[model samples]
Target: MVVLVPVTSVNWREVTRVRAAEHQRRWVADVTYYLCLSAYDGLWRSCAVQDEDSATVGHVMWAVDPEDDSHWIGGLVIDAAHQGKGFGRATVLALMTLWEHEEPSLSGTPYAQAALSVAPDNRGALGLYRSLGFVETGELSDDEVVLRRGRPAQAPLRGSG
Candidate 1:
């Protein structure tokens, strides 16, 4: 089973070692760049994607957007050797579940949805996200297409007659 382990000083080195394949290098930044970002960006949190044996297989990070209270996932890089083994999907799903149940935010406001940005040409990632219910928002960040998966609709309360 894949688990998202919070990055700490003890494991930061292992997390930084996670890297992407040459072709995917264009889509995500180096793990160190993200680690440095989390250092200054208080809202951002980084995690190491570990496998059943607790060995790091990838890296992912997220931040709660203060403006819209959206959980924005960024800097996801699955080690080239670990790609195609479902670690990417598992990591994303685990984060989504965490957001849904934990509602991470600075203002205590619940996140309306989970969001991510992908390069227009990253067909593999686009496909994976779309299949997981993330739809394009017709927006772009750093020239990457933005996508979001919203919470499922809740049933309305019935009025007593």
Candidate 2:
């Protein structure tokens, strides 16, 4: 079984191992470490996707928008060795479930929405997001495309089990 666990209580060394193995540079691994630390500071939140054996296979990061306090998924990374194995899809789904159950502030910000940007050339990720009900919002950067999925769009698919 796959499990999504809060980054707050996870072991970073394990996460670093997976990241270092997948990414080309130690910089990527270092950035992941700092990102989790920043998230734990309560300025943001992140999680790790682990297998039944407790091995971390992926990670997702998000932060509450300061202007609106709406949660925005900042990054997602599944270990290269684990790609094409459905873990990426499962991880995003789990994150969405967690987001939906979370309460919004009294400001009536709706349930907020989760968004992510992927490289335009990343057909696998684009297809996975679309299959999971995320719609293309626009371009996020010079080479990245943005996708968004709100709570309403998320409801009908809850039975995807």
Candidate 3:
């Protein structure tokens, strides 16, 4: 019942309208996230979450940190009403698939890995990240607990010489 839609294909006003107690201001959330990441000159991509009825229910953001060949996933949010319906797990799997197999392009930037951070007190989030193989990096940004997930680039198979 949940799927990812390009942010461009949806209306920001509707996405952030707080149509129900479960909804929140996505536009403002993105704006705030961007401000904090202003120091990074990387490519940012956002996807909107759609419900069975195609209503905007949540949002996710990920980007490439070209400086380090590292990718980042953030802003993984779901509506309060939709909180325990497996949407969160689905959204995350969708993101991992996006980064691992899709090879998202941004002009000429290349990324070989990805990372994320979550609030330490958010046990659900911590468990989710760990279940997906993410581990604590002992790194903190502001009050967030940073975690990383990815593998070293694989060498190309050499022709049988």
Candidate 4:
């Protein structure tokens, strides 16, 4: 069984250790943990996936923008040992559900739209996102491709007279 745990209560060192072991590329592991910490500080939301044994196998960070009310999935990382076990997709879906349930005003805005950027070479991640209803949005940087999920347009205004 996979479980999502709040980053606030998690040990970053442990997470970094696991990631370093799993990711063969030292830079990837380092960057993943760095982004994880940055997201926690900026968004106040980060999560890690724990297996049945309670070991963290993956992590993700997300937040809702205060100004435009847009939701952003900043980063996702699955330990190499836990990769290809469906944890990545499961964790993302779980986070989306949580976002959907949050109050729109306090959370900024709850629209059917969630955005994320992934390396163009990450076919596995692209496939997973596509399977989960995320589509390419034609927005790209030199190294990353931007994707979006949920309803195509902004949701109807809520609580408006």
Candidate 4 wrongly placed segments (more than 4 Å): 20-32, 35-41, 103-106, 151-161
Estimate the TM-score of every prediction. Answer: 0.91, 0.72, 0.72, 0.74
* Candidate 1 per-residue lDDT over residues 1-161, each given as its tens digit: 68888899899999988889999887788999999888887778888999999999998999878778788999889999998999999999988777777764533768678899999999999999999999999999889999999987766779843
Superior candidate under lDDT, 2 versus 3: 3
Best by TM-score: 1
**Model 3 TM:** 0.72
Q: What ordering of candidates by TM-score runs from best to worst?
A: 1, 4, 3, 2
Could you give candidate 3's per-residue lDDT for residues 1-161 as a string of tens digits?
57777665335544454232223342125433532343253466667777789887776777766567677887777767777787778877777666666674642445456688887777778998898888899999678898887754667789843
Any idea how many clashes model 2 has?
Answer: 0
- Two-way TM-score contest, 2 vs 4, winner: 4
The TM-score that candidate 1 achieves is 0.91
Counting clashing residue pairs in each candidate, in order, gives 0, 0, 0, 0
Better of 2 and 3 by TM-score: 3
RMSD of each: 2.6, 5.3, 4.9, 4.7
Candidate 2 global CA lDDT score: 0.66
**TM-score for predicted model 2 compared with the true structure:** 0.72
Q: Which stretches of candidate 3 lie over 4 Å from their true place?
A: 18-42, 104-111, 151-161
Give candidate 1 regions above 4 Å deviation. Answer: 104-107, 154-161
Model 2 Cα lDDT, one tens digit per residue, 109-155:
45567677777776766888899888898647456787877766544
